[model samples]
Target: MIISAPSASEVRMSVNKSLSSRIAFIVSLLIVSVAWSGAWAAGWSPAAPMLGPRSLHSATRLANGNVLVAGGFYITTVWNFPTAAEQYNPSTNTWTSAGTLLRGRRAHTATLLQDGRVLVTGGESTTSTLAQAELYNPATNSWTEVAPMISPRAFHTAVRLQNGKVLVAGGAPVNSATNAAELYDPATNTWTAVPSMSSARKQHSAALLGDGRVLVAGGYSATTPFWSSAEVYNPATNSWSSVGSMSTARVLFPLVVLPSGKVLAVGGNSGAGLPPSVDAFDPATNTWAPVAPMGIGRYVHTATVLANGQVLAAGAYGRDSAELYAPATNTWTSAGVMSSTRGEHTATLLANGKVLVTGGSGGSGHLATADLYSPDVGSDLGSALGSGLVQADTCAATNDSTPACSAGSTAPDRSFTWTAPSSGTFTVSTTGSSFDTVLSLFDANTGAALGCNDDVSASTFQSSVAVTLTAGRQLRIVVDGYRTRCGTLTLNIQ
Candidate 1:
């Protein structure tokens, strides 16, 4: 948990100023986890239990670094159910009961509004699907009923749009699949009917693209089919149109938008049944490509994008397993496993640079256990923090000395070193403000280009480059600028 840094003279001005204080904070936070066994295998461990089990629920990160977990069934009794809510605090590794919902439900959706409130809508209760909607205020830890959707739904998808309104789409209404879509405005706390989808689907995946439209894909349909067809919703016009479909149709798994602007469809059930294969879709081209397959076949698992640009997938039913995907090489590598086997569990990426994976259907049944995924850290791993950006030239004190790169720009370049893995492939993922930044991977001992994002196709940032690590090897990552918002990288072994 100790993160030692170079001597003060060797540190960047930005990193040195608050270095001691930040180090102390990170170290302190690291010690908060008391149950560190199986939790560590999942890369990190969860610090505390929320008031309830949250399978098939939704958790949204708020602007303040707190996560709002809402609306999922609580297995209170075989004959009764509990409608509850909670919030997780990373700084304290604890959970506090947030509030009670209007209805006891599961498979609902929650979206964090730009104003910092959470809007929760629709899920199935023991008795029926619900059309009720409510808003939770983190500051007050309370909930207020909002306008309900036109359709009672469970297993729907809700995404916040750039325009500031939330979009709720297809799921089961009452007992059948639905093609309906609705929009919720926090400004007025009202719901408006929108153009219905071309398909009736439940358990489908939806993502807001960079262009401000919603990309809707794969889910189960009543026609005895799992759909591969996909569509896009134009918020400006309140309409939907067919887009490219996934290579394979899946439901109850995960589809995440990568930092690179490509959508990754991973680990889900095809109509044929659950499949372990992962695929990537490029909206620019509306095409799909086969990438790596997950080490474990999982349906009902969770996928989260880390700040460093790697996607972490955890918790399938029988398996207490998890894995990381590096889009750079279109490959998958096993990650540290979770403490408990979970399906239909919730995994959320908290604002504090750690992922909080919580409550789900453990193999034995509903579970209250939770865990976290801490990116593996090592000297080599630290070296990866600098990849994917441009660097300026450096001037030495004398002509005989090697010139160094210039310091302090909006996108300050990065540099790091890591010993190569003995028998596995390794990758470095990056995040920075420069939209078109460049990445270069170099042998740490000798500055040689091993591979790079620039060497790949255009528009590749938030990417990874795969190379086999020798018994003991090191690599350096460099960004050509400074002053960027996000400029971190993660090293992965697959």
Candidate 2:
């Protein structure tokens, strides 16, 4: 997608940057895809694909636990902007048409209002930048035109304030960037002009801080050098103030608030190219500090705050690789590679804690494919199995007989709590053990047997059991030895 600028000169410069980036992306698409093809890690599984292909779209999770995805650009012989919208039901794992937008556009912003409605603001239509705005009511699954923005804008940032108003700031009207800011009050369905930002920028990132202030940072601008500067908006005074600048200037990135109330600016284009650098903003100190870089440089991607407080950054210009950031440790870990190499996609954290990644452009062109990522829960269990463990013959005294070991050993056992990563048949094996082993799986809450195994064959003492599990299901795994024998053993779950 092209970055919107306010002036003709800025527009030309922005287009040139976009074109060069696209050319480089297209040239490296195949190489990147091939490199990530077999690198898929655990916790990621294919979800139902979207009805149509799209990129630079919006995805919002509704209060009812469903997700609404709307308006984006696709490609055929030429760029095709679609007005179509759809809803995804996490309960049923299905997608249904929500409706169509009054105006088809891309590079827009959607904010979830407090009243349970979604506000969609200005974006670039097929022919021109648009000032039009609309709202989606989940109650009726319908769309209605609302008051338009103060000016035509694209690649802007919209943040829902604590008082139930949305603050939209820093976007390009047609070709040049604008510092103009506005507020949309859902209670009255009106737009009010707010104080402009200190810098004219587009493709920027904005997030609401814990203290009821909005933070805007790192965007593309024609008037500024580097564009690394940041500013904060105080709703109480209706004023904007400059804050500490990031070490790296960036655009087309994501800014997310951590559980600790710190804001993190992820990887983005830095004029020269995409940078892996990330920055964390301390609201109390009003300072920016450099954090750990990502495994790969990326832009036009999505960074989602997970239920566990970790951030999941997925996709890139043409990369399918995904990674996770742990604020507690200030480190990054590979989440996994997606099923497709995509960029400009949207990632929404569902109510169930699984992240749903939607359509985006890929090496093959616009993609309809989607993926679901299940974060590793009960990681301690995995860590325990990484090394050998000595089984205690303590279960016999407690009369634990739910697994029903054929040898009838009240052998000492170890039990661990594990949440199923996804719904499917998984093999639970005790293949590396010093003695005959018995493995059992049970519902964590109900204490009911789901599966048990005493041995895979008469020729082996190790046991293996395959059990079907539902995604997010909590269960207990009991590792015990057959008869009175107990020794060091290792467990594997796949």
Candidate 3:
């Protein structure tokens, strides 16, 4: 729900309230001086398992809010490929048969198309890498074979571009990796060759930047066993360019786009073993910086962006433990243990804010078990104010503003949490900002609107909001732009 920010007049009146009530405000603060824990009691819980045990599978959340799990290997005396697919209904927490694939495959990529259908791309079959692709129509609950890619690949990365075309990049065709890339146009149901990546990589990671460019980073190939190099694919120019390389070479990891538009590369294997290190990429500056590493070293694990903007990295090779990464604090917190150990799993964020983790290899073998994760929204909001940047235009999708103050902000925003030190009037301002700023406040616990301000006066582009808050009361302050203006800003709370 969108909450309107208070006007300048309202803010002025609040700050100028009679001093006669100062004693009462102090008393209220003392009465509630206890600190708030803001801990999340809900963590991981078992969900309905898949119809059968499998690993190296693909799980895609459909438009209908159901997860579709397709083709993977079921271990027995030998590796057995499963052609049957299943759909998970979050409403009922049950799994139902979706359909069957034209061929049994694993290590493939399943992409959700703009038309609400899922496109399953090339992967390894029982014998060799398969270039054949197929589309699953949720409305009809069936699969239809589409045009094959220009190259056969397994463990490749397929990212849906902003223009509705799917970009399929490097993967191993047989025993060696290839630099080949292609694009799938859903409108014409055809595949076209695109410029290949500078590096031949498989089991690498790729994410779409806010500016519509795809960033592909670190993987292994026959020539180069490990790669720390990174590059970007620009569809407008139909070209590839090198960007900053990661400090550590990684493979089989995941690149997640944060709310701030920065791409985060989670833990992955560095040839030696799993590395706990993590890195964040800034597209605006084309640089990579080290961030807080996870407590557990993991590779082939799944990192999912929670609804509250925190990242949850769960399971690894023979590990069932999970942890949460808070972008606001640059810290990691334990997310609790899962029911079973897994790697090569798929974690998909549900529409209702819960995360669904599906099949992967377990301690015994391939697993059919599934788990759900509920995030701690309150904990992610209580970070201390500091210097920040407004990156991606995520406010529109989140409806974080209203007509009162931030009606049409195409610019990005950053959020912080501040707790009242004592009872009385306090001022929250963006005095040393680089651009025109819009500041708004919300109750951290309940997410209720508190106050907001666009500017302090006619001559100033900075914003300030003054309100009386009780001691230990945490508030979420958002630093947004006037419209499309965004840059570096410092948040001051006094």
Clash totals in order: 33, 11, 0
Model 2, 1-494: lDDT tens digits are 12122244422543332444434433443343333121112377787888999899999999988899999899899889888899987655689999889999999999999888899998888889889999999888899999998888999999999999999998876658999999999988899999999899899999999999999998877766358999999999999999979989998899999999999999999989888999999999999999999998999999999877999999987799999999989999998789989999999987666789999889999888889886764333431221112222333334355357555566677676776777887777765454556888888889888888876764455778778878877878787765554655456666
lDDT of candidate 3 over 1-494, digit per residue (tens): 12233345434544322233333333433442332211122688788889998899999999988999999898799889999999998766789999899999999999999999999998999998999999999998999999988889999999999999999999977769988889999999889998888889998999999999999999999998989889999999999999979979999999999999999999999998888999999999999999999997999899999877899999988999999999999999999999999998899998656789999998988999998886644434342332221122234333344424767765677776778766888788876555567889888899888888876764555788888888889888787776665655555656
Tens-place lDDT per residue, model 1, 166-284, is: 99999976557989898888888888999899999998899998888898888877884688888999988879989877778888877899998988888788978678888887878
Q: Candidate 3, 457: how far from true, in Å?
A: 54
For model 2, the stretches where C-alpha displacement exceeds 4 angstroms are 1-42, 379-494
Q: Is candidate 1 or candidate 2 better by lDDT?
A: 2
Q: How many residue pairs clash in model 3? A: 0
lDDT assessment of candidate 2: 0.80
Report the Cα lDDT for residue 237, model 2.
Answer: 98
RMSD (Å) per prediction: 13.3, 17.1, 14.9
Q: Which pairs clash in the backbone of model 3?
A: none
Ranking by TM-score: 2, 3, 1
Residue 99 in model 3: shift from native, Å?
A: 0.9
TM-score of 2: 0.73
